[model samples]
Target: MTIHSRAKVHRMFELVEPIATVTFSDVPNEAFLAIGMRNYWDGYFAGRAAPLGMVPAEVVHAVFYNFADGEVARHIPWVWGKTTPAEAIAVRERGSALALRQLIGELADSAELAQVADLATRAGLSAPTEGRVLYAGLQALDVPEEPVAKLWHAATPLREHRGDGHNAALVANGIGGTEAHVLMALAAGMPAEKFGRIHHLPKAQLDGVVDGLRRRGLVDAAGGFTDTGRATKSRIESLTDELAAPPYDVLTPDELDQLIAGLEPIAAAVEAADH
Candidate 1:
């Protein structure tokens, strides 16, 4: 239904209340005011029987309605529009599906940090309420061991990784030491492109990697890679043999663990700071 501004606050009240689930003890004098947009997410969860949403209306407004972030003191209309529970449900379902598909699919395919980020944006558009969750969740996904997985897991740009392959090829063809540079770039968390440019490599050859993986059914390219792609990532990580003796110069296991822990917050900060 086309919600009216006059009724919007009331509609929000209805959605936020049931999900708040405050008991007598939990209720505070301040609870009466609509849960400040800041607290909505912390006090909430996703899927069913949770807060009206995984995120606050402000976040939804920002994502869907193109509402720029406001300073804390900025005044907002009492109600933007009346969004019913039914509307929230429809919005959530569509958003979640879009998030899961785009974010995961892109991560599986590119294996590069930038591509993963781009997918996060694409998926974010699917469901603003849950887009952050989806975007953050995809990082935790295990990349496969195929070409696609390598592209993603190398955490470098696709072109750079390909250049590493080319460097390797040159070394393999008796020109220079390819494998060490490949490992070094991967270890340093630099994009494959950086290495390629630094080493004066031509464009990395992804066609063969992509095609070979496709022919072997190691990747579900149609869906942006697959379980097979995830497997390929694992294998490549193993082959890099860094897991056993990972380049401490880049990241140690403990350091990697710390990075993973802060991954979501860091990504959010990066996005927030961009504007």
Candidate 2:
């Protein structure tokens, strides 16, 4: 079956359309691992799963790993992490086969670099389940609550809680068990490092996921939410709530609440613009 049904697939391209672009680049491992994990989780275990077939597993994993690991991350380990894919008018970017850890240790003095290295290692070590195991680890961090903290709450003001319920449902019940945790993390607003810390994963994995979101134009880091961001966030909340509803409820109250918290303001903004 499709990992993401046509209807569900539209969310990334549709709701996030404003920011959506034909060629948005993926995030550095530092950024994507956070967001990529959830997407992988949802796509795999959701009602519309795209289970891997008999093809070489590395092929699919490479699609995800390479897509999420953009140019910025390549600098960390030119030969392995991001560099191997870079075609110089030649193949020289693949400098050496040095362990990723060795390069990471070189930048230990830089906090940001260190965090990013940690993200890379986590992503590298992760299984090809859209890197879910690493994602769970990254999302477990504690962070300061932002204004639109929960996706589900974002809809309450618009009386769109039912829609919110749906999104939760897709992630929790509609999706499988392992992936649900990563989806919960994104809805909760856990960024890279913090997300990694809580989940006990490398921050890079979280970065990869976020980067994936950004590449799809589903998200942006520019100060506030775009119309598309608001809409998608709202839909995610609605969907989450839908998924969380009884009979086939998947997410817990806390999970649903986080989605609402992140989406509510965006919903409010959308409604305001319409009027």
Candidate 3:
């Protein structure tokens, strides 16, 4: 793909990711709680890992690649005990569909929404499965029959495919899970404390990661990116965009434009509801 096509592919997938991720909010957490999940993490881990079956925490940790150490272990096997993978999957789909309806009103069931779902589903499935663990797991499930649920389902694999590529990029650049969080926070100008809390990394450990990055000349003493750090981050993002481009190849330029146009309003609605 040309650079423009690659950027468009990245933009299209970015637009669709919220459809799947909005489930993490309170709107869907209610459904998960009803299903016997203990809390948000239980629902998040169980729902996402459901398609992989009753896998252990190590497997989840490996595939997820960015959570704090032992974070996946704190939730995985225990979550499976409270709720089966199949149940988790069912509730998440139902919950996400409900969220879409509430967020977007009648647009959730519109023909335009269906067309976007079909196009995204096509692109998501066209992605090669090799080395894409999370995407492959999502791909193995049957598509949902509900209109909004189907859209969320279609977005899941595409999100995971890009995520898996991002993990590969991080690994290639020698960035560890905690280190990745620190770098991202620095790069985005996010507050250290807020980003660290989100990743569940303790203060001491977060500092250690930052210190390590500094030793590697990737971070300055002021906690901003060094010139080398900026270059490395740019390269990782570029590689991630390139790796994520293949799925969009199935769409013609016009089809891709249509897909983005359809998703943009829905994503905006989702964001509005989230706030």
Measured against the true structure, the TM-scores of the candidates, in listed sequence, are 0.19, 0.24, 0.95
Task: List, residue by residue over 149-259, the lDDT tens digit for candidate 2.
Answer: 111111111122222234344454333222233444455665434443235444566556555555655457742344654566566555543332221123234433343
Expressed as tens digits, the lDDT of each residue in 178-265 for candidate 1 is 3334333444655333665234444444333334545655445542445654554444543322211211223333443343332343
lDDT of 3: 0.85
lDDT for position 267 in model 2: 30
Ranking by lDDT: 3, 1, 2
Q: Encode model 3's per-residue lDDT on 1-275: one tens digit a residue.
A: 43347768778666877777877877779998887878888899988889889999999999899887788998989988788989888888888888778988878879999999899899888878999999998988889877788898888889899999999999999998777877788788985657754546667887788889999999998988999998999999889988898788788888888999999999988888778
Q: What is the alpha-carbon RMSD of candidate 3 to the true structure?
A: 1.6
In every candidate, how many clashes are there? Answer: 18, 70, 0
Off by over 4 Å in 3: 1-4, 196-200
Off by over 4 Å in 2: 1-190, 196-199, 222-226, 246-275
TM-score of 3: 0.95
Error of 3 at 85 (Å): 1.0
